[model samples]
Target: MSEALEILKKYWKHNEFRPLQNEIIDTVLSGKDAFALLPTGGGKSICFQVPAMMQKGICLVVSPLVALMKDQVANLQSRDIKAIALTGGIKSDEMIDLLDNCQFGNYKFLYLSPERLQSEWILERIKNLDINLIAIDEAHCVSQWGHDFRPAYLKISNLKTHFPNVPFLALTASATARVKEDIIKELGLEKPVLYQESFARKNIAYMVFEAEDKLFKIEQILKKNPQPSIIYVRNRKSCLDISSQLQTLGFKATYYHGGLPSREKDKNMSLWMEEKAQVIVATNAFGMGIDKANVKTVIHTQLPENIENYYQEAGRSGRNRDKAFAVLLTSPSDRFQAESQFINTLVDKKFLNLTYNKLNNYFQIAYGEGINETFTFNLNHFCSKYNFPVLKTYKALQFLDRQSIISLSQEFSEKISLQFIIPSKEVVRYISLNPNGEEIILAILRTYPGVYEMDTVFNSALIAKKSNHPEKEVLAILEKLKEKQIIEYRSKNNDASLTFNEIREDERTINRVSKYLEKQNQLKKEQLKSVLDYVKEDSICKSKLILAYFGEKDADECGICSYCITKKRSPKDPDALSKKIIELLQNEDLNSRELQNRTQTSKDTIIFALQALLEKEIIIVKSNNTYTLKS
Candidate 1:
């Protein structure tokens, strides 16, 4: 067995490697950059992780998702493997300590976000650490064609010059040929060995229903497939609405979204994963690295923004390679809504300029004054203040961020924290004087003894439960403690972190990145069109259609898809209808209506047959919309 195989067995307890995983592992082990294209739950993490373990030095894994990084770090730690994630929301001292531990404590893996790669303080520290390999997860995000493109990812290519000896391994679940080429070009991967698994998912039956009542369709699908499932909606409100509807109708369902408190998200996600909740209704934010194996159904209530996103989301089903369903319910308004939300929002240079000036003005930054400045931004407040749509404003900001005008860190829901400033002996004296809220103070100390040593997460509800008081009373006590200068408390509402990477410029200079922004915006419009095409398609097999979109040549049709299944059981069969049409047209020229009437076939069937005949030159369409036999 290879060294990587031995390491995998020792750590992950996997006896065998999935298809192409071993070859990908060998490519990385040979100090060559490799791009591993695996499907969701296809074990993409293992390819990098196994090789990282067998190497001599620490593997610096750069990713953009903080929650994903957190989960991976926790998993590795549970197995007693030395790993740490240098994500956002860490204090300076804590960051220093974490980096120090990695350098000296023999940490095997250090995960950092791409935004952190640009920070001189962090990069300076990274330079001193002995590194073996650099793994880029969700590497598709580096390409503009990807569903979730981040400007910070462009900065990751800098690592090549800094660590020339350290090979890079980029991994993503879904990427088209264009996106794959872009990832290689953008990341400056040196003659990277590419491993692309076939995108054919035979067990997943893709179905698109243009129904008027989506709720009724959802019910039917759930009843038909009563296993663990996920329902992906567009926003947070829909998640709650659908999940509540399911709960009212006697279905075990839970809801999750990005806006929910982290505690609530964890509870709901856990309930679904552990089979306590049979179905989970959520937005697209839910399933990044989820490991549940038996998701039998994955439904999309509306059209997705692009094929990349739709493919990734739909691929969540049938991870066990068992029969499962991926259904999408669309309405007449879905097409218009998708176009309006995605294509119409494309900002030209003028809109970019206007939003750029408004943003700097809103932040109160003077021209040629603001450089290396950081501020807390609440996107809702900003949009509400300027009457800007949330989606458009977010896109504008992201475009500018990627253009290097500013730096936007991952938006984390801040937590309520408190640290005692007083001496331990004085704490008792203060409590004696403030006896009205003595129980709450003692509860805090009892629950989090380290709160005095460092700022720790303070749960008000847990304190209320322990103190036998209302949550309002608990909040009052914490505020009173802060008033007495006994503790420093931070509220929970803190949101976005915005840093001006350059000095504030006049509106004229803000258009410096307009050409680049325009190109990206146009690319987005094309991607959205591809998604709409997928939704509107009805002739080809859905499975084969998706495979072809990802550059699979001559993909075989999946017989289980709704298209193929419906074709199998149709009354107005095209083959039979074509024969009848040819028989009628052979005698005399006939109008389309007459042809359909004579053949006793549906209009769609007649039209399909006529088109096939026209393509084959067996028939000709003369004036008056009539078909005739070609002489």
Candidate 2:
């Protein structure tokens, strides 16, 4: 057996590669730069991973999100492949140590976020490593035309100058023709071999409906499908509201969003991922780390911001190649709100400046200070304190980060923890007083013995299960212990973090990136328009249109999309009545009444035929509601 195939089998347990995967691997193996446009669930990672496994050097992967990096690292480790993801919340010494390990230790894969590339120390160390292959996942982010463009990605081009001999493999799930070409140019890939697999998901049925009552529509869709499904909403509030409505209707449903506490997010995600809940309602935050292959349906409660996003999210279903459905429920208000929320309300340079200054004030960072300082930014608290809209505030911060003014990381769900402060003997004596829910108290003591020594993650659910008490009661007992000064309790939190890449310079810093901000704002507006156009357009085949938009012009009809199904059901061809009308017209002029009396079809159907004939110009409307031969 070939070494590549053998490695794939031994590590991934796969005897063969997916479509186009082997070709991509071969191109990379030849030491040529390659760009791979594989759709979601297309196994893009294996294209680089397997090649790296066959080689004797480390593979450097620059991923965008922390969660994605961590997940892939964990997966690699599970297969006993040594991998490490250098992300945030680590001190300089720790990062140096990790890098030292990568240099000396035999870690096969090194996953680094794009933001990490901005650090000169990291770049210097990476240049010294025996990096044989450089893989850029989510490569479309390099394109200004792409939906999630990050300026940090542009710095990746610098790698080519240092590791000029190393082959660069760029992979993205979705990208337009412009974005694809732009990715090549931005990354400075030298005559890279480009491979684009068809973005069309044949196993996914596209269903679009104009929903007057979204709740009723959701309930109906859930009742009919009843398989594992994901419902995408536009906001955290709607996520909770819809999930609650579904659960009240007796469907096992839960919600996930950035606003939820860490434990809640984990619990909800576990329920949905384990099939304990049939539906998971969430914003765009739920799909990055998901690997469920049996998702029968993906419903969008509101318009997606772009076609690329919608396709990637909907394509999550039917990964096992079973037939699934991607349904979009839209109201006129939904479109309007999408437009208003995303386009009309984008933060301008002025707003960006205001937001920048307000943020420093919020963090209490003095002017000309706070360089290289990191702070846990509670987005909700910042918005509430500044009386700014949460979504706009978030967009502004993202823009600031993209412009390299600051580095903003994804929000993390931090768990509540507790540690016993008193001595073991004092703890025993206090607990002997029957502080309440002795079973839960004992669970804490037994489940995590080191809690007395250090802060340990507190799981109220497990305690509740063991104590035969409600989760609320478990929390209450924990708080009671905290009140008694017996244990230190830290509440669960959801907070994003921000690191000032430069010193606080207020308006000067915001002005430095004003042009860049304007450029990104325009990109976002154009991307939104693309998605809205898809939602409103009903005549084109859903698959055909999307494929064409992504630069696949020769795509045929999917034959099962909503548009194709409706086209097949409709009588587009000339009916018998229409044929009769043409025959009558060949003989003599005929009025509507005359046509109805002469044909066996209904009056409306006959008139419809006459209109059809008139449109063809084989017959002409001589007068109002009258017809005659054009000749």
Highest TM-score model number: 1
lDDT for 455 (candidate 1): 58
Put down candidate 2 lDDT per residue, 550-569, tens digits, no spaces. Answer: 88889888988888887786
How well does each candidate superpose onto the true structure, as a TM-score?
0.77, 0.74
Q: Could you tell me how far off, in angstroms, the CA of residue 458 lies in candidate 1 after the best superposition?
A: 23
The clash count for each model shown is: 0, 0
lDDT per residue (tens digit) for residues 297-398 in model 1:
999998888887888888889988998889988898998988887788877788778887887899899888778889887765576567776668787887
Model 1 residue pairs with clashes: none
Task: Estimate every model's Cα lDDT from 0 to 1.
Answer: 0.84, 0.84
- Candidate 1 has its poorest 10 consecutive residues by lDDT at 407-416
Give the Å shift of residue 266 in candidate 2.
3.9
